[model samples]
Target: MTDDTPQTRRPLRVLAAMSGGVDSAVAAARAAEAGHDVTGVHLALSANPQSFRTGARGCCTIEDSRDARRAADVIGIPFYVWDLAERFREDVVEDFVAEYEAGRTPNPCLRCNEKIKFAALLDKALALGFDAVCTGHYAQVILREDGTRELHRASDMAKDQSYVLGVLDERQLAHAMFPLGDTVTTKEEIRAEAERRGLAVAKKPDSHDICFIADGDTQGFLSKRLGRAEGDIVDESGTKVGTHEGAFGFTIGQRKGLRIGTPAADGKPRYVLDISPVTNTVTVGPAAALDVDALTAVKPRWCGTAPSGPGTYTAQLRAHGEETEVSAELVDGALEVTFTTPVRGVAPGQAVVLYQGTRVVGSATIASTRRAVAAV
Candidate 1:
């Protein structure tokens, strides 16, 4: 909606998406403490969760569902598990594999947040008469004095998760809540509160790495699914240095798992500079070749409203990535982002999140990167 923003309506009826982690458990408790009518809903996202951590922190396992139920009981709220396994496989899993096969690195967490948690789950909660969807995202939804809600970075800079939340639009923001968005709050403090509340997940370890790839072997996982296609590992001159099983298994800026036996004549470590799924080629070069001069992102979503004109904003290329000053302009329906200084590893298909100070303005899927003239 043009000139539109999410408006916060009070007397909250909240549906917290619990993921069986300490952060989410505490976030749900905070929502309840705010005197809102809160219900806990845990998503069963795996069609067949590998029974590994179901007894602990695995979000898709039966233990994860039980842990959520325990947290809801502690908060004195009704808890239910929503079976979204098929949808998760379609939207998140399939998309991840496809993006890699297309020679682009994708963040599945952001996709899950955008398509599943906020869009799919929130839609269900609303149909059930819930006012807002709450979560453990380390980001703030601030209601400005003039009556508009803006998403901001979480107080704990180390744990801020607004980058993944950048896919949210005005409609989603209108019905979203982040109890852990407080800048002064830390994950340690949240866990301590859970202990005080006697919640079982207080000491529960935070889920790490990609959730679905059970053993975290992305290469093995993708090769098994997408199958291997032999390709050449070329240098800047197009001379083959070595060969690879598949370009989809590698990512931009990757150094390890190269398996290149021959070293460049210059005798410096090489890095993945580009991947061409069309030709199934993996290009390697020195680190400076990875320096990105500019980028064009497609289909940006503003958290509140888009900037009236082109201006400088802090941009992050990766989740928890360092911020760099960048100038942005709308060009031919794409967000053209130019950095005052070069940024590294700006992967296409990963979301480039923009922030004006602490407030998250919007983000877009990075379509391509413009390398420096020195690189060429």
Candidate 2:
């Protein structure tokens, strides 16, 4: 005779990062409804333990944490707040200031995704014995036939956030869940769902990307952080035309706030060409100089398990920007993207995300940008 005992499959436990927003609230509820043991967690990024920004509708504030807690309670799940201020300051805030000082535009949200969300929080969840980590990011992941994960654009193209998440590698993709990915739910639908559930923040406004920089005073933030350092703004021919508060205040391809009066020799509006931190000068030139067809990026990270062979792809230089068809040639530790048509306003120190169809193949930090000297 043989004795038979029942075997039990453990329930899937998901740790959802709730920012007290409608999207995340709905995401957690959906996960719970799908039979997963869901727990909502909010990250506190404030420097001071009790200090939270005013009208902070996003994550990391007391009000947001309360909202998250209330949503979790309404869903009959547990919730907690994790203090990650030190990590945020070091990884996101410092990197932002340093990149601007070096005359390079920085994507702080991308940095936060790489350093805080997917890296730190993910590790913590794994260590705490959670089966998976979930976020409200508008991106999707697909498992291919070869058992490899692929990152793809969200079905809602207008709300796609694949650009910020392009830096994720195979490992992170394996253990992450984006509940808002498969559905093409607009922001209005999400708010309606939250309201139907009687959850707060249903009508709350969306939060800004750089929440710490109040009033969107990037120049003021840099001035206060790095101290005042004056510089001269010059033209293409190296003629001094105007003065600027700081070199970090301006970025490549900027045409406004140049403070230049005289028209160019061709009588055209002057644009920013180069920012020289060494000489402390902001170079201005005609708009034509900003056109670029070629760009190179370093430390490339691919989302798929494909070989780094040469192939044609589309690339986006900025978040939410149009994707331009391009031919990609992978070199030793770098990717050189050449546009089919002359693409303009390519800047250094931004990310170049390559895509094959809707799937993100890889991404890299822009090393340099240049216009095609010869037509293809």
Candidate 3:
């Protein structure tokens, strides 16, 4: 009779998401350098692989897949391409159109991170027997003493991407790896690293625009996607100022391109205050109307443990933006936040990420906002 005990390996298997950019290429190299058995995966999110435009900013094209594969080769790791165009369209593109039609601005990158990279993609990796999935996001995932995972801002605060990723739950964080978190690597540094390694994506410009909107035709895309519904552009007093092609064309707090020449009595710049999809009207007002103090966010997703009572945290309404000190309360699964200083133009449907110092506590979708009923 013999007794045997098997030992697990120190280095783990990781799947790094490569987007044909220097950041992602460096991420794969860092993963390999960290002693992990890394494999690069590029998500193909366009039906016409050749139609994937890279001159401007976009992702998930055949060319991008090839660049990612080349980077993987340079890093001495295996590579594969996964066709996720259908899922991306359904989860991100359709949702963006729907939200615009509803007169609410949507953050498609946040949706992509939540549904695609961390959810669907993570599931696929787990099924393939990978211990973790890595990305080039400038954010950190810290494991707490109680075995719960927490998200944090990256070392490069200016490049930190924690806002869009705050919606991730603990389960996703447990299997997620952000290779570029601890380093203060600028965009140039990543590219230089890629060039030093002779990676194909060394000089690949980062994707700046939404992947689906290759021509940067947001208005045209919305018109085609949501169907043109004629609307009236009105002033603060509900007086019709001009006509709009559709309600989906405007968003809250937009300042320019109203095309209304009518001069106001006060000679102040008119900004977008509200948009009504039902009446198909875009309401314009003075810039004063954009200021908001309190905001309500629905579907709050806590990072580790859900807040049980009223607490103070820094709240950021926009991604890659500044955080304002605020008091947050967990009320019936929603977060009611009162900014310490008035935050202007906080729009609905934007993500509100709460943080305690450098650690991301939770996040929610902004459902409503107004002047603070009470001071914080």
Candidate 4:
């Protein structure tokens, strides 16, 4: 007799990380429909969890866990909440503070994806015998004939999130599933499906800019965590133009909040061009000073096999920034991304995600930028 019992037959087990949002809800539902034994897991990240999410944007609050449970219930899958507060603090929160204090702008969401979500959660799911960890990320993983999974941008280019998820390596990609990849063409479509399935968070607004900073005051938040270190606001000639409360509060390319009394000799408004953490100095310059000719990056991460050497690729600096054609050459142990056309707002400690067309092939953390020597 053929063995067809639930206890005897092997089933595909997937752990879906639900964030109490419509995307994750629909993603979990889709996973269940795909014949996988799916379990919904909501990660409790905030140390001081709010009883309810403020307004419609805030997330990871107590309300999210309840919403995730309801979605799991509707999908007829098991649901559980995991407390990753300590890990999130160490990996994501502290890292954000440290990066800013070190004179580099950091992306906490990307760090969460790199350290907490994929690394921590994926590790835990694997130990529990789950085949893969599924998320609602707007990126696709295509399993090729060569038995390698390729990470590609979603059909909806506007909503493509491959940039933030650039840290995933080959091992992680092999066991990662993005249910909302190419299937859900738009956010509205995901919401409509959630509503059709009776999921309550269908009409929920997207999460806020920074979830941890509930009040949306990043400077105040950083100032509190990392104590204020008053510094000098200087110009290109090293002349002190003004004074600042804290050096950590400013970022490169920042034009506002400099609090300078007078404009430069050129009569043009100044933009933050450099931040010296050691000297606690914030340097402001004209708008053209922000342009970068090349960027040197470290901690390189290749999606699949590491490329041999120097080659031409699409270099995407910021998350929503335009992809500029560039030539990437590996020198010593770093990746040097040279642009034929100067790029703007190229900050250190930011991710420089490389793309071979729509595929996210590799990534690196920008260590430093080389600007034009001549005046603009």
Candidate 5:
């Protein structure tokens, strides 16, 4: 049995992943204060950290590494920087590009949590004799009487990150620790805690958007990686409305930058309804065309035991998206979910995470969506 097994009150050897942010720094401190033997490690994700964005917009930069080291010093824990640049590039970065190339809207953050943080990092920590991998994610881990663990939402719903972490399976949940999960405090309160703890990153701005996209220009980034292949943008009647440099630049439900030459007959704004990588074409239509009522998701990953059959639950379609009631069934490894009410903006390659109330049941990569018949 692992040292982190339920009912074990012994001091655990915890490896805290410090991202040079206030949350992680304080999480490490709290773990140490709770008598865990904690060590701080920063993942050097970018091959050339200098080229990545800096300050409030970036997560893995040279500045971030330095800040993590300083936080470790202040917390009096052993610190190290692991060069996971190769793994990160292959798993997260390359996958992000490939997904877009396939005309799917992939969430790199969810992929990173599944492929890099929980799988790669947790595996390495275990090999190095660490009992658990701790992070600053605002999600709770519940230990049941049978020594099993469950992942649940954080106390602060606004700050809850269980959606992105729904990819963690049972094995990963066993060795995971979230020190900031139960706190009902606000972001300012967390920062104040960091200030009181004498951490220098107390006022550091939270990183936003895709970290690797340094300038926040996702279209420009993809254009550089995938190269510009001018494609036609057509309406529902198969009439060309506009042209784009690449079909990969458009996502489902995108409204702006379509560069449509003609106005709609109804003059209602059109949205990106579909992107076809095979034909290199983007399809635009009315907002009603974007309504999705059902989804067929692949690669289902359950946090604990897989559900026995179809069950009613709430499903979160995106990172910050609201959860909607859904009836989910696991059939031949795919998750079939039907939302009680139709949802909009759902895209393939994004995850559809199901929840039984506040507990994260599992997540799957959205393979396809069924448009609402009423909208048709």
Candidate 6:
């Protein structure tokens, strides 16, 4: 394995994506400090920047742009704002709504990283002669002796973002730089470093939830986009129990806000077991019904080389979720994964990232799931 230090690498032109957060600002500063020719750029992902709320948890806001510009000024690097609102809306926002409408939960962050950051932005940077596109993502790119690259979790597992970044293919990994990956420091330490470097966003609050949905109300956001179509909330046996304005509002394993008037026969709480967009129905059942033992996924993106056959790996079902042991293999251009034990709440359309130790093996979009035989 190549030395896990950025200092040993030769100076090159780096295009740092400054997200107007403490992490990105500090990352840009570190790149410039290491003698790399770094230029900072903030992605304007909102078409109507004025309409988006400006505050701690909002991303791509005008305030965020200003913060990014200020940080670039402090870092002594040229700053620019790239208007990617149209692309973001088409790729990330619309994709999110579509996934929901199809009765699946989607991770917009993963889509943004895949389509906007890596595909669109990275391509543009490379066209402009930049050798690499750097970001504040808490993940590492390990270069092998053979010159191939591998993506891995950050040293600080608490802040590791490799799950969202699992969509990066080998080509994208070649030109990606993550300066914060190897650091064992806490997020507070990163903020302190930014303060020492005179970066104004040192204490800026981190953005969370869906950036496009400024209000943090996902149900409201989807309703506005897709328009409400009243649907039936039914039990697993197809018995209607309640009604919802939109079936898209529900997701697998959701338990609250179901508005079911009558309790279960056994007086147990009911969890969302499935959603059928075609029939416009949401299926709820006992918590035991949510156990998933196996899943099939499509569109696998390998970080390095694709696995040759079946392998024992750890699979992360969602971002910030715990990794569970799984046996995975590629079959007929799809990924089939079987867990060592039943995992709950494995939903379709979510990316399942596979890892062998700390290194990211690949990721695939879950297509379907199967319950354990015992549970069935």
For all predicted structures, in order, the TM-scores are 0.95, 0.93, 0.94, 0.95, 0.97, 0.97
Give the winner by TM-score: 2 or 3: 3
lDDT of 6 by residue, 50-132 (tens): 55654666678889899999999989999999999999999999999999999999999999999999999999999999988
Q: Which regions of candidate 6 fall more than 4 Å away from where they truly are? A: 1-8, 374-376
- The 0-to-1 C-alpha lDDT of every candidate, in the order given, reads 0.86, 0.82, 0.83, 0.85, 0.92, 0.91
- Backbone clash pairs for candidate 4 read none
lDDT for model 3: 0.83
Model 4 misplaced regions, further than 4 Å: 1-11, 51-53, 374-376
Residue 284 of model 6: what lDDT? Answer: 95
What candidate 3 gets wrong by more than 4 Å, as runs, is 1-9, 52-54, 372-376
Per-residue lDDT over 1-376 for candidate 4, one digit per residue giving the tens place of the 0 to 100 score: 0012232134568899999988888988987887779999999997787922566656789888899999999999999999999999899889999999999999888889899989999999999999878888889877765667678887788888899888899899877878777753677878888999999989988886777877777899899988887789999899999998788898889998899987789899899999999999999998888989899999998889888888888978888888999999888889988998888778898999999999998889999999866473
Q: For residues 141-213, what per-residue lDDT tens digits would candidate 3 score against the true structure? A: 8765465677889989979999989989888887888888878878888788888888877777778877778
Candidate 6 local Cα displacement, residue 289, angstroms: 0.4
Where does the lowest 10-residue lDDT sum fall in candidate 1?
1-10
Candidate 5 residues 1-376, lDDT tens each?
Answer: 1224443378889999999999999999999988899999999999899777755787999999999999999999999999999999999999999999999999999999999999999999999999899999999888887877899999899999999999999899888888898879999999999999999999999999999988899999999999999989999999998899999999999999999999999999999999999999999999988889999999999999999988999999889889899999988889999989998888999999999989999999999999997532
Candidate 2 lDDT by residue in tens digits, 209-269: 4766754678988999998888899887788888988999999889888888777888888
Best by lDDT: 5
Pairs in clash, predicted candidate 6: none
Candidate 5, lDDT over the whole model: 0.92
Choose 1 or 6, whichever is better by TM-score.
6
Clashes of each: 2, 0, 0, 0, 0, 0
